[model samples]
Target: MSTNPRGPNAIDRHVGSRVRLRRQLLNMSQEKLGEELGVTFQQVQKYERGANRIGAGRLWTLARVLDVPVSFFYEGVSETLNQPGFAEGDQTPIIDDFIQSADGVQLAQAFARIRDSKVRRRILELVRTLAAEEAEAQAAESEQA
Candidate 1:
């Protein structure tokens, strides 16, 4: 059930997810971001979860602190919205969903800091192999059960 006529919408969640993604990509903790925004970490959590809507002024301030243009928050959002002139993009509306997660963000940030292309490629292969092995193991276990 929703709370009100104008409660947090899908756009709000998308924006918050972007905020969390950007903050994670910067390796910034929620507490650190909150300190920068002069808010408590809990409030930051709320904003990140889209439980509370971000106001325009706060969004402007967040843009500066997050070192991203205000438009960054709206990047994939318009794809899900059916507003006039807001359609037709190759961007997947849910693309940010994974990177917005704690694990996904940490993996991406760590992988991004790798300067050696060879090492990066090796790591990618290793991860692929591990994932494949895990999937096979899960399938085998299911069969056994």
Candidate 2:
């Protein structure tokens, strides 16, 4: 149960996103993760969705099961969360969601296997050029409409 009426806290969501990201990167299913944690897959889903708060003990277990340090979950947490008027719509969560997706994980794994820095740089440049072209095409289409 979230303490705030507004759903899961930002920190909880961030932690959940990290959990999902790591789990996906490892190519582990939620069912497998839950089996290792001795919990139901539904419970694992809740943890990943931030619907349920993970206690310290459970978090420690998660770290053990996931083979990540407990601090990994907090790696990219914003320093300005306590500041007034902090914007909630950050790109990190979007990127996290993508990284947790099947296609994104596949792409990331393939990219990681590329040991040549020049090849990696060329692939990145190709991707950027494609993205810029897509964006320009969309803008032109919108103007035409």
Candidate 3:
């Protein structure tokens, strides 16, 4: 099989995404992580973006700094590799893409703060309705085009 000449294979990207997820979950800044790792914030950005591959030693340091086990980065990797999109060379997972966004984080934090289960369900229903409407609008626009 031909390899990516640019940078970072699927495993690298997946690992990087897990790192990003953990960092964000802890509300840790790339600059802070860089300080802990003795690297620049730009370097941390590269690692998170999968523009640069992280070595084993550095990965270990990252796990320690991020307060997770070394194996945390490998979770869900098998399932991701087996997905149809992976075969088609689509590296970005939809859920990860959403969770990595600022809006997604804010929404998740806010949703989690709501103690009422019934209210949370209503909010979920509202979001679903909005998403369905958006999908319908896009479908209609595409048909017109």
TM-score of each: 0.77, 0.80, 0.83
Residue 138 accuracy (lDDT) in model 3? 100
Residue pairs of candidate 1 with colliding backbone atoms: none
Candidate 3, 44-106: lDDT as tens digits:
988988879999999999999999999999998876677654565555477678777767877
Instruction: Give the lDDT of residue 22 in candidate 3.
Output: 86
Please list the residue runs of candidate 1 whose C-alpha ends up more than 4 Å from where it truly belongs after superposition: 1-3, 79-95
Among all windows of 10 consecutive residues in model 3, the one with the lowest summed lDDT is 83-92
RMSD, every candidate, angstroms: 3.8, 3.7, 3.7
User: How many residue pairs collide in each prediction?
Assistant: 0, 0, 0
lDDT, model 3: 0.87
1 or 3: which has the higher TM-score? 3
Cα error, residue 25 of model 3, in Å, equals 1.0
Per-residue alpha-carbon lDDT of candidate 1 for residues 1-145, written as tens digits (9 for 90 to 100) = 7568678888888888889988988889999999999999999999988888999999999999999999999887766465577646744544565676788777877899999999999999999999999999999999999
CA lDDT of 26 in candidate 1? 85
